[model samples]
Target chain A: MAETTDLDVAYVARLARLQVSDDERRTFQAQLGDVLRYAAKLAEVNVQDVEAAAHAVPMFNVFREDRPRDWFTADEALQNAPRSANDLFIVTKVVE
Target chain B: MTAAELPALTISELQPLLRGGAVSPGEVVDALQSRISEIEPQIDAYIALDFEAAKHEANAADLSLPLGGIPIAVKDIISVAGQRCTCASRSLSNYIAPYDATLIRKLKAAGAIPLGRTNMDEFAMGSSTENSSVKITLNPWDKSRVPGGSSGGSAAAVAAGAAFGALGTDTGGSIRQPAAFCGIVGLKPSYGRVSRFGVVAFASSLDQAGPLTKTTRDAALLMNAIAGVDPQDSTSLPEPVPDYTQLLGREIRGIRIGLPKEYTTDGIDPQVKAAVDAAVTQLQALGAEISELSLPHTEYAVAVYYVLATAEASANLARFDGVRYGHRTEGVANLVEHYERTRAEGFGAEVKRRIILGTYVLSSGYYDAFYLRAQKVRELIRRDFVEAFKKVDLLISPTSPVPAFKIGERTADPLQMYLADIFTIAANLAGICAISLPCGFATSESGTQLPVGLQLLASSLDEARLLQVAHAFEQSTDWHQRRPPL
Candidate 1:
């Protein structure tokens, strides 16, 4: 496990698109450090020959006839948008 | 049953009454509404109750259907069209669901009324409902203690007679742990057994929605309504659905039940261990064979779960940016700042902690060490179950290491709280079916009785046997009939 001091909490939080307060950063750094340290126990297991399993049950690709089906209308889709104009979700200006 | 007593009856009990014209569906809703009004203030089990809508549905309920007119509370995380799908988070506090989750759609199709939205940990993140951005759901047994969470509110409502039965989602013990703490039955079907469509994702690989109910039979009845393949959820198994209640009265004369030694180690509460041991003896008396077995990889389950579940959560929750449905921030300089500030202000401490940890593990420098390693260990955990089931029909243990702890007790220490779910996480990791039912009760430090849960785990798609055994044990004991002082 990486040392607790080694985790750049602010940088990771930014990567996660979260803005943590200084207090939150300090608190999460300690709490998450402990969690990661505990999780480090996984390294002791001999997984050299074991293949990683993403889903416990084996999955196969499912297919259906290529056809459209009834779904939410445009108005219904944008009904929950925090900000919308016409049928589009309004957002902060981009590509400035 | 009189109107005053209607709210306390289980779905199985009320079904006949509703069918016989002895109790109208409208009356059931009225009785439940009154009962909810009386108990909800103390328990805070519900986030929102829509009596007007529920009554309308009840009045038109098709009595011929299985769950007709039965009112089931829903965890706020699952979408119920036109109801608030807050997920007990401030981010979606004003967000009403535009569509019903597939599970909700199935329940309604079976004639069940979606009665109220129950509180939960923010995005179903915490073991105790203390992390809920809304109000804390208090244990019905003792208000000083918490109802186990993120399905805490659903479990509490069922326990306190605020609702007959409720829907809960289990990612890492969310349903079963709370059900254990509240002294009810909670089932986590084999991962693909239930549809996850429209249910807010926590850890997609781990999450499965199931029932929290007053009796195993009610759980089976709910399971019958909800479990099936859904084209909407690609991971939903294409396996045929069974009559989960068919094995309720079947004999278990030669069924092999394994008791994993690791689950009974020193960290468990003495009384909890005693109760589970007694339950094992009772199952033996009922003609089941009990044996001690090892699931050596057991200790690493919570470790692997936290890593994988949080990793998935960090990705799943990315959709909650300010541009869309949930909470948005004002006065942000740019889109990036808006996303950061919105999430920062919206999520609770535990959610933030998990997101950060998840982000760190998946980040460039640590992916192979943390995320990949956890998945491989997760496979080992899954293999442990696969190997154990070869010799035993089911595995039994205490659902939680201890009963419901007092509210605010473990909130400050996240790791301590994480460890509380140690016994229940492995089932999710293995993607197997499991259930928790009230095996017995233990007196707390203050002498109040708290429920102890007996967990039963079966191989993937073995819910029929799981329900059969749980029902047999439940019927053999008075634990399920014991009501809280409330």
Candidate 2:
């Protein structure tokens, strides 16, 4: 096993837009440390000239002709919003 | 038809009966309702059921169409218009799908009825269905044990005869492992074979929606209706679709199978190895040549899978901000606080763990060491399969290291739970097709006999050959014919 360093749980959580409690921060830090340690095994492989595969199949520039088609109506798009007013999503005031 | 006969009928068996007017769709639905009412309470396989709606659809169904009137369970992760597609999470518990998924539209066009929404791991993250916030789904074979997951509900429902067949999305063995645990047939089609248009994203690169059925032929039957390209999904393949059921009962005289050496690594239970070995012998007897092969990078599959899957999941799941359709936190001071609180409160522990792990790997200074390295390793894993296929047409292994464990056995250790998916995850990572079906049984320490699965894998876009050989093996054995005592 590799000597894995502890991850900054609070910092990562902030980037992920998740508010972590103190206890959760401790738990995640230890757990993430263990997983990263296991994941360090990837470094043992010689990937000298191997290309990183982002997609399973080789796909490039998959585009269809730019044509307008029927899409979800505004009512359908906003159907699931928890709070909506006047056909717009209601959210906390920005630009204070 | 007698009530006992209804649950045992496969899709092929019911096709003629419905077409010839020997049985009405209403009768089929009634029989299924009786079976569900009896077994559903004990198994907890369904998150939601629309029996009245299904009956209405059944009554109006055109009996002339393929798959006409067959009731199929839809995993909650897939969209069913006007239905609650919760993905077994509290985050979207109240959200209803605005429109049908591409697969759903196809199934409806083929005259199949959407039976109900099935439970799954929250965000399809965990191996066991215990991660579901809705309820723990029990194995119909033994209520004390789990039906393997994250497709546990669909597998359990099929095993319990609650639905004729079901659909499940496989990412890291979510479908196959559960199907194995429940002693049913499950297929994870090649990544692009099935559209992911409205299937809730877990690990986008790994997820493919496939069928879970009582038999291999039934899996082929469902695949015929649901497998195709969709304009809505850019990742969908433009490959020509074939009638998967057309070649059922085909001969497999010259098929070559490879048994990888790495799958026999530590932690494989003796009973599971014995069952899969016996299955290989049985296939050999049916005239398919078998050989030993090696995939040296197999040991690193689990490690590489976690890095890439979590990274994709973290990005995909970021859409669930409180301002949108999912659960939202109240009394937040600002937009940032609202986003933070909503995510913290909405997601479960396992989901949050992956999110943080993903966020960390994709973070600055760690991207090269973690994410990029894992992707390169992933390429090697795919290359291993590509090379192995040169020697043999397909590979065989144990779907899981062991049968279903006690419900709460591995919940305390996420690593232990992740290991349950070891054998099935590689196929997904390679974007290849694979299937799991009953091979034999494993007796537990308590004398409970649980089902074991034998997995078969083929190279990408070789589903036709894969199904042909699987159907041949299935027809020769009685394993798929057995049902749970439930």
Candidate 3:
């Protein structure tokens, strides 16, 4: 078994942009550690020369005609937004 | 027609009656509504029921269309115009979809009335419906036990005869496991077989929407309506859609079936094993050549799935920041806090854990160690199936190791819960199509009879052959005829 190190729980949570409570962080650290340790069993497999497979069936660059088409009206598009202003989604201020 | 009789009719049985003018669509919807009224309280099978809209749609339904006014329950993850597509998460609890998903558009175009949105694991996350923020969907067979999830409600609804058939999204056995636990037929079409234009993404690469129905024929009818290339979804297959229903009565005399030795390990429930073994005997009697094969890398499937699926989920879910749509945090000072608080409040524990784990794996130093290694092992796993298929026409296994446990049985241990999908996740990883149907009944400790699922997997886009063999087995057996007592 690869000697596992304690996951930097806080740093990882922040990177995911999730505000996990301190209690949740502690609980998750142990739980996530268990999952990762179990997942470490993958190292036992000799995949030395195998190519990585991403999507199941190999199809790529699935493009369509580059032409304008009908789409959601501005009202329809912004209907689900928590807050909207003049058909634009409103969000917390990000700039000065 | 009485509510008692409505829950017992399959889509094929109802279609002729509907076409012959023996029943109006309103009466059909009313019969189903009555059944839903009788059972929904006990099963908790739906997130939102649109009786008025369903009746209105039914009244105006074109009986000349393929679906012929059949009412189908949709998983809350799939959008239906003007209906709430909650995905069973509080974040989108109040979010009503403005337009229909591609599947919904096809179903509606085929004259299928969308009756209601069913419950599921929050954002299609967990194996059991317990993850839903909406309500717990109980197994129609035994209320104390759970309906398998993240498509639990759809399975339970169909099992309870609340809907003739339903739609479900399978990421990692979400549709099949629940269908097994609920004693229904669930098909997870090959990755690109069904379009995912508006279905909420859990793991983009693994997610495919399919059907949960009482019989294989019903699943096939649904496939005919919904399985087609959609220009809106880039990953949708370009292959011409076939009439899947035409192959139902076809012969399966010389089909080669592979029984992976890895799937028959000791951890499987004895009853489930016996049932699948019995199913193999039945298939053999029908002239299918059954042979034991090895998917040697099977042991790594769950581990690889978690690594890759979570990585994809972490990235896919990033779109749910508190900005555009979904739930947003209030009183946030800055962008960072807004994103943090919104996600913290919006997502469930399992979703958060997966996101964090996904982030950890895809993080800078550990990418090669965890994510890359898993991807490489995934290739080996896929190659194992490729080699096995060279010798066999299809692979069969028990859908879940055990039947449905109590709702809280595996909640404390995420790893234990993840193992619930040990048998079903590989098909999703390999991007192949698979189906689960009731094999037999196993009595629980309390003498409650639970259903076991037998799974059949086929190579990518081979649903025609997959459905044909499954339909033969289903017609030869009485398992699909059994209904849950709600």
Candidate 4:
């Protein structure tokens, strides 16, 4: 188990793509620190031979025969987009 | 029956009236619309209502279908084609679903009208609707207190007679907790029993859409339409769907019911404990064999749930960047700034808090300690249920540790609010079917009468037996018949 410590809220916020204000950073740091401390209880449990379960019920991969089917038109697909031009979603420039 | 009396009828009761030519489906919609206009100011249950379109659909409803002519309110998170699927977040506040969720499609095929979108905790994050970016849904029983949340609006709408039934998604006790608070029947079918194709994703593995209604039979009736495999959601099970109402009036003789010792601890309110105890006795008198058992890992559920659910949430919510849909920041220099600012502006505080926590737990070095460890502990929790179910057909407990608390009560402390779902979270972790129904009432110090819920759990895909037992208990007690003073 990794040693528990204060959460670096600013760093985590940046990683999450969420811009946190200075006040929010301070509040979140304290609150998340408390939650992490409570979550540290899991470290005490013996899990030597246990398998990690990503889902509660066992699931199997489902596949269907490859076939072309009618789906959303470009207009329907772009209906809720924040910005769209032609048939594609518009966003901030990625490459210079 | 007069139009005023139509809102008080359950889906099952309304079906006969519609079939027997006594009432039209459009009249039901109008009655509910009138009721909504009268009580909605106090409850604030619905986020949006489109009765014009609902009445349009109701006019053509086929009475031959199972749920014919019933108007089921939908939680804002589920897509219903043209309706706004805001998820009670500013991020998706103006967004409209381009297509219906598989569950909505099934309900429509069963002749049910999708009435309106109800409020919820922002992105289904908090225990109380106070976390909702839209509005807080007050408990219909006591307007000063909260309708326990994420699905608070759905439960309150049903309890207040503004909706015949409603759809709610449960990740960790969202449906059951609110239902317990509002004094209604809420079912969380076993994971993967319902499709998640168009429902907004929270914790993908844990979330299941189910019914919030006035009675167990109504839940069973709604469940019959919603449960089944869907090609759109890969995780949905391929098992044969059964008639959920098949065992409704069957005798529960010799049915083994277990009471978990871990759940009977001191944190539970005394009134809540007494209600569940009396419910156990009632079930015993109805011929169920009650015994004490242990699901030893019960204490770690909230901890494990927080870590895993938040981790999954962080990944799932990444789709909300300012590109394809929803909110977009006006001024930004580049892609990175656009992503950051848009999310910061769009998501509410609780959603942001969870996103940060999720990212941290799944971050470098701490992954093994928090994320993976929680998953392993999650396995242990599931195993505990598996072992206990071997000795009993079902388990019983209080859905929430306490009844509906004051609106601003737990808002200051997130952990305190998370603890309110103590009893209901374990079933989601264990991938089991569970139901919360009205068992009794708890009177607050201020002299407000609040509803207490009795929770029943059965192994995965055993909804038939779960509904049977819940129906038996509900039929024997007058609890389901008690109406709020609205």
Candidate 5:
């Protein structure tokens, strides 16, 4: 039996802070299940004792000199937002 | 300025006219705007085209840049300084970028006007632009069908005569597939060939920035402008960027071109097969040697790509919390709900599905069975290309199995959608260089007329050689000259 449920989809969306419509929730539930159906093929291989490979271009723990650099200013950062309050993105206190 | 007559003059041809004072950049920009207005109702190529701003840029650019004033389109996922970088997601719909992407800076430095951000699959997650949260981008070749995506908007923009060239990102064939579907040239350079500093990440591991143009030489020219290391992205290669255009006229006299047997196996389109074979023959005529090569792990490409891409998407998307520039839900009293509601509302079905699958695969219990094993398979797939590269200078294959399908054709089936990218995804996974150029025509199941693409791939840092092959074949064919009936 598949280990997925409508609640799992709803829960995941909730965790992501997205408000999905009922139609969207149903669409995602089925689509996500089908996507997982193909993704389950990874379970067939034996990966014990194998090291992990992350980035396609191989790099390991890329380090910088730790010198402080002045990144974009707060005013510049918020320049493109539709709304901002006190140098921060303005959003409704969205919690249930 | 109908689409029929537009394909004859490449960006290189048009730029010179603008530069030599034979034509004003404003005239060219106006011609494109007029054509876009005429056909965009049916094709739906652009999410936003800043025609007024572009005209201003073109006027200013004529006096400053080398190309008098060539207009360029940017994939929606990338930032253009102060413009909106939506990635076709509602989450960032209200967000505008604070700075330009490295390539956008480079394009502007070269005097290209950014018309506006083109539409894309939401978060650059799907093969078809149908996954876009904003709006769907249709193929310019046949308005009813899909332009290969997440760069679908870029492809459609160029295909429909909205612009001469455009920039696109490729994680899993986003650039090449759409270019193929739209009958243009798309190049995905070596992983570090272009910096990803301000381009929104979908799958950082395999994601790259490259060009979509009307010809391979234009791709090369754009590559020359865009390719290089940047201080912003540390993984960017520090090597000197080579001159790609100079290599076009040179003969590939003794270069070895390899045809991968796995690519030509069952389920291959007969027309695509014939077209690629003819391209191979043309390469031979151009004094290049051809050989049959085998990549045994070809079947594992899709499996490897999905696992790795999703795992990265899961991590990269975590930054879109309510605290940032993107959308945040209101009326939720708590912080946790803030994150949940914002994402649930912002992300599309495909993105939500992938995030869940990605999270599930990387979760504790399934880590060993899924993520670790998939990494090992990735190593094996990369090795297959490395071994094949030792035998041949370049690999040839059909870019997509069939031509473009209708808008709703494969939307219902998830895996079937993924199958379209089977051939083009391998190069991204392997971190190699690949180019897709127009090959010939493909008749769809419904008797629709579409164009097929032939992909030329090479090992890492071999873009010069790949472009040489593409440019050589393009010299022999008139397929690149064909455009939409509009």
Candidate 6:
């Protein structure tokens, strides 16, 4: 089993942008270990040389013409925002 | 229409009556309203009910389309022109979509009325709708137990007869597992069979929208209306979309069905197993050739599913930053604080955990060790199905290991909860077509009877064959008509 540490859990939470409670942190460290341990079992498979099937369908640049087409008005779009100001969604100001 | 005392009506059954001028769209919507009013408090299947709009649409209905004014619920993850697409999270709680999902456009074009948005696991993350920030979507048959999720509400709505059919996205069995737990018909077409233009991304590689209905033929009909390629969704498949309903009575005689031995492993409930076995017997009696097969790599499916799904989710959800739209938090004085507060407030526990795990695996030091390795395993898993299909015409399995459990049963145990999808995740991983339908009943201590489902999977673009087999089995069974007590 690959050894997982609290640092790993903390780093992950940071990346996920979540605030993990300290009490939950310890629990996650252990839980994350178990998950990684189980996932580590995949190392046993011999898939060398097999091409990965990343997306289900083949990819191509399928962009359509950038012609202007009237869609929902900006006012209609902002109608469902819980809080709005000046015809745009109003959210808490960034600290910076 | 509590699940009980109501025999579920499929779109096919309602469409003819509705189109032949025997029934009005208003009648169907009104009947559904009464059903929703009777059951919403107990089942909590819908989050937003658009009765006024539905009535307006029904009154002005055009019956020339294939759907013929059938009422349908849109899973919260899917967007509708002027309706909220919450994806069941506080951040997107009031996010009324600016445009209709491609499928919703098709439904509207086909004359289907939008009943409402149904509840789901927040951001389509969890197995059961327990992670819904709003409320638990109880299985219609047993109010205390959960309807499987993140498409749980879609299943519950269909099961409770609130709608003839509904839309759901399958990202690691969201559609099928819930349909199994709720005892309804749910289809997850081959990964790109249907466009994903407006279905909130859970795991981009695996998310594909399909139908949750009461009958296989209805799933086929719904899929027919939504399966064409969309230039809007680059990932949508270009395969020819055949008329699946027309293929319903197609012969499956001498067709080989593979029963993967791994699916019949130790932990499956005896009742679920018996129900699947009985279905297999019924299929055999109807002319399908059945054989036991081995998918030795099956043990690795769940592990790989979590790893890859999370990795993709982390990448896909990165777009929900505080700046452009969605929720934001105040006070911490920086971009980072805004990002942190917004996401923490926006997402639920299971969703947070998955994002964290996904981000971790794709992070600097772990990418090669975790993400890349899991990708290789995923290739092997896909190959396993490819090789298996070479030996059989299709495959069958118990949709879920057990019937739906109580709402809070596994909420605290994330790993235990993830295990609920062990059976259905393989299809998403392999990007294949699959469906789940009621097989029979299972008695539980939750003061109600529950239903289990038999799952059918077919190779990509082979949905017609899958529907033929499912329709054949459904025709031979009476389970689909059994309703829960009010």
Predictions in order: chain A TM-score: 0.91, 0.89, 0.89, 0.92, 0.69, 0.71
What TM-scores do the predictions have?
Answer: 0.99, 0.98, 0.98, 0.99, 0.92, 0.94
DockQ winner among the candidates? 4
User: Model 3, B1-486: lDDT tens per residue?
Assistant: 554586679999999989998888988898888889889889899988888988888889999999978999999999998998888887887788988999999998898998889999999999989999988999999999999999999999999989999999999999999999999999999999999998888898899999999999899999999998999999999899988987888889999999999998999999999999999999999889999999999999999999999999999999988676789989988999999999999999989999999999999888888889999998888889899889999999999999989989999999999988999999999999999999999999999999999999999888989999998999999999887765
Docking class of 3: medium
Residues B48-105, candidate 4: write the lDDT tens digits.
Answer: 9999999999889899999888999999999999889999999998899999999999
Candidate 2 per-residue lDDT over residues B84-137, each given as its tens digit = 999999999998999888999999999999988998989998887999999999
Worst 10 residues of 4 chain A by lDDT: A1-10
Candidate 1 lDDT over residue span B1-486, tens digit each: 579899889899999999999989999999999999999999999999999999999889999999999999999999999988999899998898999999999999999999999989999999989999889999999999999998999999999999999999999999999999999999999999999998999999999999999999999999999999998899999999999999999888899999999988899999999999999999999999999999999989998999999999999999999776989999989888999999998898999999988988898878888899899999999999999999999999999999999999999899999999999999999999999999998999899999999999999999999999999999999999999998
On the 0 to 100 scale, the lDDT of residue B155 in model 4 is 93
lDDT for each residue of candidate 3 in A27-64, tens digit (9 for 90 to 100): 99888989999999988989888888788777889889
Worst 10 contiguous positions by lDDT, candidate 2 chain B: B245-254
Chain B: TM-scores of all predictions? 0.99, 0.99, 0.99, 0.99, 0.96, 0.97
Error at B484, model 1, angstroms: 0.5
Candidate DockQ scores, in order: 0.85, 0.72, 0.78, 0.89, 0.43, 0.48
Model 6 residue runs over 4 Å out of place are A58-68, A71-96, B1-8, B445-447
Candidate 2 lDDT at A86 equals 91
TM-score of 3: 0.98
Question: What TM-score would you report for chain A in candidate 5?
Answer: 0.69
Please give the TM-score of chain B in predicted model 5: 0.96
When sorted by DockQ, best at the front, the candidate numbers are 4, 1, 3, 2, 6, 5
Residue B149, model 4, lDDT: 87
Better of 2 and 5 by DockQ: 2
